[model samples]
Target: MQTFFIGFFGLAAVVFAVGVFRTSSMMRSALALLFSQTALGALFLAMQAEFLGVLQIMMMATEMSIMAIFMVMFMMDPGGLGGMDMSHQKRLSLLAGLGGVVLVTGIAAYTQWEGLASATEAAAADEQIRQLGRELLGRSMLVFETAGITILTAMIAATAVAVKVPEQGGSHES
Candidate 1:
């Protein structure tokens, strides 16, 4: 059952990832992205990483909701009005994607995976998660905080730029 669900979610993620790019409407694309992220989270849960999986799903839900709201509010045709075309430089993009796949495959085929063999013992799931939390929040706290602040700053700047300021004497609302 677990194996089946893992495979299902993996396949769903791939399909939805494609949908993210192929959908004409911004809202549809955002939904696709949300679904793809959720599918990936399920995949992680199937692999027994509960914390990361749940966090991924929750984060993506909030992010996608905000994204869809922004798209609807700011975009001229959030629904793609009349089937807006989305792709650009298709041939080059396809070639680049194929090249990336080939490169990654070659690397995976040649690499020696020894980390699993070096496990100290059969550690419990929760302990492993704790170690991950320590690694992220302890050793990498600065890096994580920097990334969070950077993203927040960017969002603030983008909102400021997108917002329409009413002129002093003019009534902006018609």
Candidate 2:
């Protein structure tokens, strides 16, 4: 049952990932990415990584929404109404992608999984969650804070760009 769900979500993630690249529309691409990330989160949940799954879903939802907003604001044709091609360097990109897949597959195949901690050595769910909270809010707090500030800055910039200023010559004050 678990394996089935993992496989299902994994396949869905791959399909949506392909959709992200295959679509020419910026809005569609962003939506595809959101679906892909959500599928990955579901895969994590199927694998029993509750915290990671929830975090992935929440973070990607917010990130992708912001991305879509920025795209709509900044892009000349965010919906791809012009039907322009979005991809570039096809041959090189294909080779690089293939190489990455082969390398990752080799690594996964060669790694010794038995050396990792067994179920007996594994911490309980509540304890693991507490440790994760401490780890994130402790040493990793600065990184999260920086990311938050950066996102806020970007949102402000996007808003500024989207705003339409009055023409200097057209609007004369008395």
| Top candidate by lDDT | 2
Global lDDT of model 1? 0.90
TM-score against truth, every candidate:
0.75, 0.73
Model 1 lDDT tens row, 1-174: 888989999999999998988878999999999999999999988877788899999999999999999999988899997887867999999899899989999998888877546653435679978888898899999998999999999999999997999667656555
RMSD of each: 4.5, 4.6
| lDDT of all predictions | 0.90, 0.91
Residue clash pairs of candidate 2: none
- Tens-digit per-residue lDDT, 79-106, candidate 2: 9989888678999999999999999999
Task: Determine the C-alpha RMSD for candidate 1 after optimal superposition of all C-alphas.
Answer: 4.5
- Model 2: how far is 36 from its true place, Å? 0.5
